[model samples]
Target: MSDPVAGSTGTAASGGAPLLGAADLKVTFAGRRGSPEARAVDGVHLDIAPGEIVALVGESGCGKTTLARALLGLEKPTTGQVSFDGAPLAYDSRALKAYRNRVQLVLQDPSGSLNPRHTVYEAVAEGLRIHGYTGDERAKVAEALSRAGLRPPERFFLRYPHELSGGQRQRVVIAGALVLDPELIVADEPVASLDASVRGEILALLLSLREELGLSALVVTHDLGLAWNIADRVAVMYLGRVVETGTVEEVLTSPQHPYTQALLSVLPEAQGEPVVLTGEPPDPTRIPPGCRFHARCQVLASGEAERTGVAQSCRTKELPVLSAAGTAQVACHWAAAKAGASG
Candidate 1:
């Protein structure tokens, strides 16, 4: 059967509510008393329905991690809200605990995330204990480890972080998340640290778990290939904002925003010469007066944007809000022109 979370039908088919969502989410960090505050996550809106895997793609320092933290309520948003199952999340201690029980996080580095001193059993059992699981803890831990593909489960129960291979350590981390039987998981750079051969295995495991358990996931990574490999949808982030969002095939194959185009151009499988963007990304403390990406955008740099006066608009007007463009939603003044040209 087609999974409801995989987007084969209407939202009602998936229980009429997004499993998790963020609306107008923003997170700002105070700088020195007089200095401008740093905008880490800026007005990001996203949603994950049941059983869906959405990849959040962006370069370093683009606030993907900050957005993830906000969704989990680990970092309170400076503005906007995170909703789960159609209701806004509350910050009360009891509410936060209940939210966390349903949404877990898998960090980028297994070696760093898992305590070297804790044996595999302890690490996996920790979440169960914290959540007040009263059933047979041993069975729960073993089932979680088994689900994460550490077969026999018993074989890995006593292994420490140093004793297991990198892949195995990552699995232990995943088991910890699974032990909670969460409805959603926010995985940050889940495979960036693993060996090339092991990365595919880990990704496959996640996809399999989604099929078997009906879990939703928001996978944060800079790897376009990873999005293509596993995600049903893709969100392209730049300078703390989402510039484009669509299915993996829609966004990757025919990117609408200039930043998205520039990203796709560099993919090894892409045929053209890499599109080298000019200028370093602006400091978060002083994001440009208009579109945050206007400074480095190739389209704006080219004379094309000048002809349509879009370049001037990009420099002086507020960044365009995301709007529909065929199958994708793109935030750009020049998207229509680019889409027409591509068509």
Candidate 2:
């Protein structure tokens, strides 16, 4: 696989300008009862090139969803900027409405995303009606449905969400996004809820869509397996920040960050015993002072950092945010030190 990061240009894998990009993005929610603010997304920089698929992988509550929301303009950023086609994203109602039309969202639960009362046709046509599409609404809806793998589009036009299987409902949701002819799709856990048999079908559908439509995507998921299956690039996020990022082949096969290593170690196909970190992720309200992942870092706990004389730094000195627009990068002091020594 080709490296998606193009030095400092922040271009996509295709070497074209990013269809969507986030720079130093942060989202913070005010704490209640006079508590400190909770930083949902600290400082993330990610980009998706035209027709490229980038997976944002992390455990729950690590802020991958918040980062996705920020990219979609659903949540306002406390700092930083989101840009599409090289222009900064605007949050005003009119601007956002247009932005959403170009960048559609495909949620995880198709059942919840679709209205139980609405027929397939209504659900797919809703976007056109809202966007005031002047073209033939029926033709557009049918095309979207066909593209989404719902064959004989007219056959399912009148069907309700309850009438379709899990995979079919997901197709309808994807069709809804496709109907708008969006440039990019931000699918949050696109297949996490499906049966094991149905999961591959959905993943294949996503790949086919990318091939057919040249559509770029930012898939938010926790499953490294899913990332390996569909993503060209993978960004491993921890504690509201990206800790490691590179091509899927590079990052998954040889992950450098301890958090990423721990994640990959637990995969069913992994060679050795899993590396299980103790304790839950630290409270986001009061993140650790140095490396956000320091407390649970296995390398630090194993005395590797101590052997290398970077143990103290891991506990007290902070590392820079790994840019999402570069070659394989890691934020761990030990990993960087090891790389330097090897080089």
Candidate 3:
């Protein structure tokens, strides 16, 4: 019913401050003069401390990509604000250019992100050239390639996109981001296109990079298993809002939000009866008035109200913001009651 608020702090390795954050961000794209505007991201608050690897997970069209873009300064928020190092985001040419050097984006498809006509050297060096790097550009490109696990960098320097395997092309994209020596990386489905075997390698590369360079990453993905594999913290998005977020173990093993429960029930390793959501997620332009998930939530349909107000609140009251439910923060009216029953 009310705007979603995150109650969990999550596990951030850095104690002093977050390296990047989004404070109550909302991004809306206006439709035709008569049509309703599409609210892609609605009232999201997120924090990424230095060197933390956080996963933003959801089904397609859940606005994870839009939120990531807002954090990277790629898209302007319709309201609220984005911050870097405790300061509001800067938009001036000089300030924005400096910001770009600190944060880089790795798109879902490397073939689409990389230039088909450019050599590996040119692809990686583009950032340096644009950023006005006066040093030896060749050395920087070679080192970045090497860091991305493409050893003997010169071997692939002249290779075209068609020449390299799917895995290698993705590696080139990562190398391009690394060439900038960024402090944060916003990787959107970094391994979705690669083979299953290559997925592990790319994830490993991300971990190794964090260990070696102390880089913070915001990984956007739909695969819950991927979040289990590499993320220190996981934020589960439904429609335009975050429903649950916590350490990977807490959220995965004991999800509190109904949407999250439904999602995990379909996981390959999930046991017992799976929750098959009956209806399509509500359209962004016509989001339901109360709890967005109420129309399809099994919990609301079958749950016996432990108190007088729970059921009435589920359908009529605005959904509650994230509140502490054991180890996770959940935006649901009966998360505590459900946890108690399960326990």
Candidate 4:
């Protein structure tokens, strides 16, 4: 697919580190009902520096998985691009083949992802086989298993997907990705299907792998609290665009976008009254004109909403800008003031 959105055109280009970057990405699919095309992932821009973990969070159908598909070159985009190591990639056979080794992905469901018939050894060694493993396949299998914390290696080498528990199956999946020794990894809700007790173990394994390999990752999840704790940076998506992003401390502590603030405030221990968002998310088919969050925002100020007829006319009709200074970039009317105070 072509690069989706514009890349580092403004600030990301001025000075940004990019191991993997997605620029101005738009992913639209034909409507199931033969209606207008559904623009699932629209105009997203982000960069993942070498060894940094960035999480993409949003409501389920707001384009998180679709964006991941584009990033991994699994799905083509309507317009825009995703690049690796500071270079844009075309979907040629060579480029696609090279991507297989340079970047790998951990899927959400281990059971569905792994072949029930293939032994763990076969699954992990498949990457080696495809890439032309000329040496000891057994040695490669042992190394991958060890790295994924599958002790002794031999115990898991003969196990099949159904024979292992949920966490073990996930470990096998991780082992498969590791065999490629990828520079970047796109983990799509690695823990979502596991039992709650197994979630932490899987997350820890991921963190360990990151530290061991110095690998950059884009972790996708709907849980903001998970992103807050695991990600080095967080990008909040709503409708189809990235509304705010920053270092974990900056975004989590002082979120600028109402949507971002609302996301953060919903966490268990977060103070203040529970901010209930009214109305379902706007349909992706006919997104609102500007500031997609305006439909459900509490930050527009009640009186302002009444006087400006914003409730009826949307006071936030003007498209806001996304700004970054130091480690924070937020798309909000108030971010400029924060930038001013910092200056």
On TM-score, the candidate that comes out on top is 2
Q: Provide the TM-score for each candidate, comma-separated.
A: 0.93, 0.96, 0.92, 0.87
Task: Report the CA-based lDDT of candidate 1 relative to the real structure.
Answer: 0.85
Off by over 4 Å in 3: 1-14, 303-309, 323-327, 339-343
lDDT by residue (tens digit), candidate 3, 104-218: 9999899998889999989999999999999998899999999999999999899888899889999999999999999999999999998988998998999889889988899
Best by lDDT: 2
C-alpha RMSD of candidate 4: 5.8
Global lDDT of each candidate: 0.85, 0.89, 0.83, 0.78
How many pairs of residues collide in model 3? 2
Cα lDDT, model 4, residue 117: 93
Span of 10 residues, lowest total lDDT, candidate 3? 1-10
TM-score of 1: 0.93
lDDT of 4 by residue, 1-343 (tens): 1111112122233465678778788898888777888888878877787777888988877888889989899998899888888789779888887887888989999999899999999999999999887888899889989999899999888888889999999999998999888988899998989997998788778777777897778899988777765777778888778888877666777787777777767788788876777877746786776567776777665454454334444433545434223257666544444456578
Residue 25 miss distance in model 1 (angstroms): 1.3
> CA RMSD for every model?
3.2, 2.8, 4.9, 5.8
C-alpha RMSD between model 1 and the true structure:
3.2
Please list all clashing residue pairs in model 1, or write none if there are none. Answer: none
Candidate 1 local lDDT, 1-343, one digit each (tens): 1122244221333445677888888899999979999999878778788888888999888888889999999999999899998899999999999999999999989999998889999999999888899999999999999999999999989989999999999999999999999999999999999999999899999999988998889999998888888888888888788889887777887787888888878887787789998898646787886678888988888877888667877888886555212236887878765666778
